[model samples]
Target: MKVQNKIVVVTGGGSGLGRELVLALLSSGASVAAMDINAAGLEETVALAGMNRGNLATYALNITDRAAVEALPEQVIARFGAVDGIINNAGVIQPFVRLKDLDYAAIDRVMNVNLFGTLYMTKAFLPHLLARPEAHITNISSMGGFLPVPGQTIYGASKAAVKLLTEGLSSELLGTNVRVTVVLPGAMGTNIAVNSGVMDTLEVKGGEAPVKMLAPDKAARIIIDGIENNRFRVLVGADARLMDAVYRLNPQRAARFIYDQMKALLPQ
Candidate 1:
């Protein structure tokens, strides 16, 4: 998907990796509809891109709102004439807490934004995508999607769903012009903690900030390239790849290692 002048929609386009992806797409000459719940952040992202009119647009809407998402395709078509791709990037991560200790509201919020949001966006834009010759859908999962995170169980579950969903969609769309790609990103230098409203509750394990935190810009580039080449799976950093390798080699042992490594971050 040489994104030169193609139309792309990125959820959570207001900040963090989503923002970086939007910028990268615009730089590649793609007409973008940057959507996010945070209107202010979306405006800021547009300002940063500095693209000419018609090259970039902002949609301040919640992905979890099915009605809004359903209407997006029409709006996008009106502006760009067609939808070429969608990056289901909007997601939220709560503080590391065991399932038993987590509030039901928190669990629902995470699932609504992370899992349901991805589904809503995918379903809404899929028809439009099918109309294109080489349309793509990139769903951003996490390392947590592959290996279980003891404390952040709900988050892990949501991303895990994304992992399977992306793969299943890929298989289902095998013979179609549309393609599905999944992205598993290890820790990256982004404002996810702050933006997700969990910064105050976040706890670091092993008395360290955590390793393999790639910069958002680097992650964005990898994502773009994956979409361009129609990759099935793209791991953001070495940590994610290593974890995936271990998990595939021995699932139980990988889970144990993750539990042990993340012991400190668990609630007392």
Candidate 2:
């Protein structure tokens, strides 16, 4: 569905790809309700909006809270009169550790934000989306969702759940007005590591992190394009694209390749 003149809700809109997505959607003439847990980050996003700020509204809420997520539809609909699309972009990663070393608290936080949060938003807005003349849902999974990333095993598992959830929702909503698109994004040059608190635990808090990533604006554009075209699946970066093909060809080899690359990030 075309986003022009449409009301779209974007979760994780405080910063990173989510902020860029909000700005991009506004530029495309879509009215956006940007939701995030970071009020300061939301304010920063609004400041960055400039002329497009008029079309954007910011909400501070935790997507992991099901009650809060359920209440969000009404709040957004009241602001925009109706809703046409939802981008479940809010997610967090697990700490760099093996599952055996990972605590249940960390696992729950990752699963709650990455998996259940997406599920809650989808369920809350799906009925409303189906009632619309035309609508769309975009869920952000990750390259790790498809390929094993060693230290990020649980993070991958959560995103993998999102991958299947989106595909399954797409299957279930066939012939309906609601269209579902799943996004698998490779690393982007964002503060996700900082924001998710992983960087705090690591020694490399400086600018010496390995692996250059795609720009957030570029990723937002690709995702928006996928939503506009109602694509079944969208891969945001070359890394994700290459890895997808590699994983399909030989899952074990791809897993090993990724493990070789990411093992350095894990604690020794």
Candidate 3:
């Protein structure tokens, strides 16, 4: 669906790709409701939006709260008149450790933010989206969702659940006014580690070749283009595209490749 004049809600819009999406949507003439748990981050996003600030509204929300999530459509409608689309982009990563060393609390937190949060937002806004003449839902999964990463087992699992959930939603919503799209993005230059509270514990190995990271603005553009064209799956970055093909051709090899790359971060 075309974004012009549409009212779109984006989770985790305080920073990273989410913030970029908000700015991009506003520039495309869409009214946006940018939701995030960090109020300061939201402020920063708005400040960066410049003149497009008029087309944007910021909401400080914890998507894990079902009650709060369920109430979003009403609030968004009150602010922007109607809800046409929602992008579930808020997610956190697990600590850089093997699953055996990972704590249940950490696992639960990742599941709550990544899987359950996406589900809650989709369920809450789906009805409103269906009511619109043209509406869309975009869920952000990760390259790790399709290819296994040794140190991020729980994070990968949560994203994989999102991948399937989004696909199922797309199938179920067939012939409806609402369109569902899932995004698989590769490594991007974002503060996700900081936002997810994993930066301090995340270990990086030196002497490893640096991988080119996708910029948030570029990623946002690709995602918005996918939404406009109503694509079922959107892959951002060259790494994501390459991995998608690799996984398709050889799932085992893809898994092993990712494991090899990430195993260095795991505790010896």
Candidate 4:
């Protein structure tokens, strides 16, 4: 579906790729409702839109809250007239530790924010999207969802669940007006560690040959293009694209390669 004139809601719109998506959508003539937990960040996103600010609305929301997510459709419609698409972009990572060392509270937090959050938002807005003549839903998974990273096992698990959930949703919505797309993003230049509150415990160190992370703006563009074309899966960054092929050809080798690269961060 084309984005022009459509009203779309994006979670995690305070910063990172989510913020970029809001800006891109506005530039493409789409009205956006940017939702995030950080009010200041949302304000900053709108401010960055400048003249296009009128096409954007900011909402400070915790997507994990089912009641709040369920109520969002009405609020968004009141602000933007109608909801045509939703991007479930908010997520968190687990601490850099083995699952044996990881606490239940931390595991629960990751699952709640990453998996349940996406599920809640999808369920809440699916009806509204189906009502639209052309609508789309985009869920952001991660490269870790397909390949294993030693220290980020739980985070990978959460994202892997999202990968399946999105694919299943796409299959189920096949006959409907709503289109579902899942995004698998590689490492990107974003403050996800800070946002996930894992910065102190988890430091992403560069290897001997450092991998260049993709920019948020570029990632956003790729995602938007996928949505416009109603693609079932969107892979962001060269790393993500490479892994997609690697995983398909040899899943075990791909998992081992990632484990070797990331095992340094794990507890010795």
Q: Rank the candidates by lDDT, best first.
A: 3, 2, 4, 1
**lDDT of prediction 3:** 0.93
lDDT of 2 by residue, 125-215 (tens): 9999989999999999999998888778899999999999999999999989899999999989988878888875545435365566899
TM-score of each: 0.96, 0.97, 0.97, 0.96
**Candidate 4 global TM-score:** 0.96
List candidate 3 stretches off by more than 4 Å: 207-210
Error of 2 at 201 (Å): 3.9
Highest-lDDT candidate? 3
User: Model 4 over residues 1-268: C-alpha lDDT tens digits?
Assistant: 8999999999999999999999999999999999999999999998999999989988898988999999989999998789999999999998888889999999999999999999999999998888888899999999989888787889999999999999999999888898989999999988988998887765455533235789999999999999999898999999999989999999999988887777666667
lDDT scores of the candidates, listed in order: 0.90, 0.92, 0.93, 0.91
Off by over 4 Å in 1: 52-54, 205-207
Clashing pairs in 1: none
lDDT of 3 by residue, 55-142 (tens): 8999998999999999989999998889999999999999988889999999999999999999999999998888899899999999
Q: What's the lDDT for residue 206 in model 4?
A: 59
What TM-score does prediction 2 earn? 0.97
**Whose TM-score is higher: candidate 1's or candidate 2's?**
2
